[model samples]
Target: MIKQLPISVSGSRKYDVRSQFAALCYRIRKNKIQILLITSRGTRRWIVPKGWPMHGLTPAQTAAQEAWEEAGVRGQSDGRCLGIYSYSKETDENGHFPCLGMIFAVEVSSIADEYPEAGERERRWVSRKKAAKMVDEPELARILLDFDPRRPI
Candidate 1:
């Protein structure tokens, strides 16, 4: 499993950054690469689904797992690394992450019928251009651009 770095989480206590990670995933449908965007509970902040890591999983595997849990979609991954980004993690209404987050590339393969975790979230398939514009984070928007069909990650 990837390392989880301890950091100040805004909600109730310190959170481990290294122990958790985030991921962005894509699926090609109708000749366009569609990115999956999610809405989190409470704050309704538009972001990708991500969470703590599990044992015996690679960072990419962890990312793929997060997609399944958070977005209800199953995906494979590209050998090409889309690279990492950082965010502060928190467990509160502000919805700000209180720790630095690392990002990875995951390829969408299938979406399950059931949502096993928090249903406080919903997901949608959108164009890379629209997906990039949906988030406020520049680095995250840039990550979406990297997934452009014409732009190789």
Candidate 2:
């Protein structure tokens, strides 16, 4: 569920913070945990698949959908939120807006080459520690550093 946080206003400006769902996609190979990172279409920065909430879908479901669309991931979400991280989303018309992204762990079963965003982004598999260092968001980095899929959430 999305939490309703208070919106802060600075003088005449009101900050509208929105919520998004993200998929922390991972898999076990050679007895090691590997994380899947994808480049953002616009900035080409390494990031997990994430997007705004969808109608009639739970947060975890939305996250899985984003993973399929953005990274060609075919996976199942654990249905538990790993954590929430804040970032500023850039837009052409309204500048930047604050967003809270709730992360769900997805144990990837397979990846296809011709998914929705195949032409728009790049995908890579890396160690969790490397992924933590690759992302710009500190909170997300910490989450990646501390995440242990074997431990119950």
Candidate 3:
């Protein structure tokens, strides 16, 4: 099993059988991050290019897969993982799927003209300032705020 770092918020913490997913938020031309805002078939508000892992791939590799699956963008994600954030979901009203996400810096030379999964969801290459305003999550916003294209990871 992969070791997960314990997360704490206002004196609460979590861990279990399922795991936190890792993903990359890609930057297309001119250091703009590609962000997707939408719901799962299960319906939850989130901003991510994410999914569960397949056996042979590492979390980072799985992140790359999710990027392609969710965003229809292809590129090299050789940047180092910067950090993690969490969000919660539920299949049923009372139960929840609390998830943590590791954010990585990714680069794309090109984006596909169409995304297979873009239905009802909005996708864009947003400037860091615009991205910060688009999301409610402070953590995701911080990632965009601290995003310096000229700096090497």
* TM-score of each prediction: 0.76, 0.88, 0.70
- Write out the backbone clash pairs for model 3: none
Residue 96 of model 3: what lDDT? Answer: 79
Off by over 4 Å in 2: 1-17
The prediction achieving the highest lDDT against the true structure is 2
Candidate 1 overall lDDT versus native: 0.69
Model 2 Cα lDDT, one tens digit per residue, 80-99: 78999999898676788888
Q: Is candidate 1 or candidate 2 better by lDDT?
A: 2
On TM-score, the stronger of 1 and 2 is 2
Better of 2 and 3 by TM-score: 2
Give the C-alpha miss distance for residue 151 in model 3, angstroms. 0.7
User: Judged by TM-score, which candidate is best?
Assistant: 2
Task: By lDDT, rank the candidates, best first.
Answer: 2, 1, 3
Instruction: Give one clash count per candidate, in the order shown.
Output: 15, 0, 0
